[model samples]
Target: MFFRALLLLLILLCSNCENQKGETSPILQGLLALDYLILSDPDRSSVYFSTTRSASVEIAYEDGAEPNTGNFAVAPTTSVWSVTESNLINAFADRGYTVNVTVPTDLSSMSEFPDQGRSTWTINQLLALVPKYKAEDSNFQSAKFFVVFVKGSLAENSGVIAVTVSGAFGIGAPTVFVFKEIINHFQDNLSPDKVRKAEQMTVTHELGHALGLVNTGIPLSSDHQDTAHGNHCTNTSCGMYWALGDDRVDSFSPGTNPLIFGSECITDIRDYTP
Candidate 1:
């Protein structure tokens, strides 16, 4: 296996030696993509949910979804990354894993989703892009997770805030998608801070799914899984609650912590051995 990987690396370097710097050859891209297929596992959550080694979460935003301080002028405290990264670190720290989440500034050098020129996306479309983008990550093998923020909605008006796909999806890389279009629709008549927190809540919630919350992959410590909703906690206060909330968006209130796992969910994570 070691020699095989070394040969592939040599091929990548030699194949691109005369091409433009930072651009991978078609053959190299195909080789890197094979890594994704080989990494596919039946147990999607265990690799991320209970890994003893430190893990990395890489984030990318589409052209429209790029993070900007300008959004703060329209809605105070609208920093998407600050809130999201903080909540992720806090949650994973509780589970005894050191998680590092990053939003790369240099996305032009990486593989990107093709310009489909649509306002909404389907899982199939995004799944096809996984191996391509996943191949670009330098830390692809170290318990890594991929997240992409796009300015669109899920297909057929699914009305979901976000979605998570595990190895079961056959993509190998576990991925989380946050739809800025759906999140923006909820900002009407509400403070940006509230909307900001709600968006953060959604990101963490889907990531919870990636971590195998409620009995998806990590077994339950108690009977709190809302089986009706498929891997959500029954507790209303929990971020993992199914359907999240209505269009008005009132799940988060002042002085209430919306970025959290319910106690039951935490118990399951902490008790997980693998």
Candidate 2:
């Protein structure tokens, strides 16, 4: 409604300006003042509300685990994806964003995850099963996002554990797809806490993409974006670190190097006024 009013006002002013030629009438001045007020109004523009964002998660689960061990509906917080969500929530909060995460109670089957035993699935292929996060909002200024958890791993040939993709040529619609098999691999290799940290770091790193870190969309504080690393930070300690997660796990035990978000990446998200 506000947008409509703004558009109508603009159209009327444009028509009046056209009809009146160059005559600076009182009515034209009034219209100009109204336009200035509209642009400066907090309720009309996004200047006041850019600080908050809403985010949600959808988990794609396997109906039946081949080993009958893994389940998505169990204590959701115990899920590796939950760890990831928690880290994201904290990161955004630190950046002064209000993050809301909702996990659907019902778990969908592996069919929602992949074609068969092990297959590669695209973002559209997966998002078809569930809708992205949306708001029943009168105010359209809020930032909204959806992060998806695919219950199975990608094809063995595909060396990646997860990928972050944006909608329509990476312009806006932000979503993250995490392969459960990757978390499963970490769970087997690391201790319980370390596994949790690994999951948290994995999701946090991907969430960085959605937040436009490493010069993807968010401007860098420095010329430190590792283009060679593909939208990853050059500093290894940063959450946007580009190295393969599995490779880093073997190398950096909690005793030596901890999983944490880099200050550079955090600053990018926090200070990104756009």
Candidate 3:
């Protein structure tokens, strides 16, 4: 009986050690860098990071001039693309991973060129564009989230990140929508650098939602919690905070390296990622 007892204790200890190792595996912390492509300028944007290669990105632009259409503009210089890509990569890198970006030829012309006067496109119109590109490649099936630019009002109800989570796993991948009206509001009120940083913050914030982060107050009992499982940021400075303003880029600042979700959120993502 004593020998059997010793054997059982040894088995339990070995099991515990294996569990701890699984929790700390490097794969859990490894970076998955994203590549960008305008689709239209595929050649120029094809470059990628040496470590952990990236998948292609396709951006679609909405015609801003049509009646009721929104105003979205892309910078004339290639530097704009580079700067945006660099900003996103840096945001991820700050969290301990190296990121690389690539711009595709198809996305070159996918600038925000919305007309100043019209407001015809609705959220549904913008969402319809997602499947077009998502179906183009199989890699997108694994994307943590996707970002799209749209022309619309930045009024309190103007922008949002739509999330879809399954059962108890919490949030699945998220799709980020940037409104032209909000971007313009920042441009007029803040410095260029601030505007750019704000844009990056918004996109990153939406991606956080896609990755299982949730607001502090949202009831876990709700079905939404089953999928949207990240922590809520009470710190207004943190990106996870839900209340953000259109006029100030700093309104979105929790710093680039936003905090991870509570234990629940982490568990959900761990189950989903692998």
Compared with the true structure, what per-residue lDDT tens digits does model 3 show for residues 1-274? Answer: 2333454565556555668564533322221111112222111111111122343333544554111121112333333234334433443343234444443333443444444343534545555656654434323221323556656653335443222222111212234556645665644556655555555555545555543355321223322342232455443454555545554344323233223233443333333321
Model 3 stretches astray by more than 4 angstroms = 1-57, 64-121, 133-145, 154-156, 159-173, 186-188, 215-232, 245-274
**Worst 10-residue lDDT window, candidate 2:** 65-74
Across 12-105, the per-residue lDDT of candidate 2 in tens digits comes to: 8767767857666666566666556555433211332263455554344433321112323223334434444554565556545565654332
Clashing pairs in 2: 239-262
| Candidate ordering by lDDT (highest first) | 1, 2, 3
Error of 2 at 60 (Å): 3.7
Per-residue lDDT, model 3, residue 6, is 52
TM agreement with the true structure for every prediction: 0.68, 0.58, 0.45
Residue 22, model 1: lDDT of 72
Q: What is candidate 2's TM-score against the reference?
A: 0.58
- Candidates 1 and 2 compared: the better one by TM-score is 1
Compared with the true structure, the alpha-carbon lDDT of candidate 1 equals 0.62
Alpha-carbon lDDT, every model: 0.62, 0.53, 0.40
Per-residue lDDT of model 1, residues 1-274, tens digit only: 3434675787768676837667777776776666555454523555555543445566666667643222233334444444455555655666544656553333453234544566878888766656656643323235566777777788956577788875433345568877877776754665655566566677778777776776766788889888888878899877778865644245454233434677888878778776
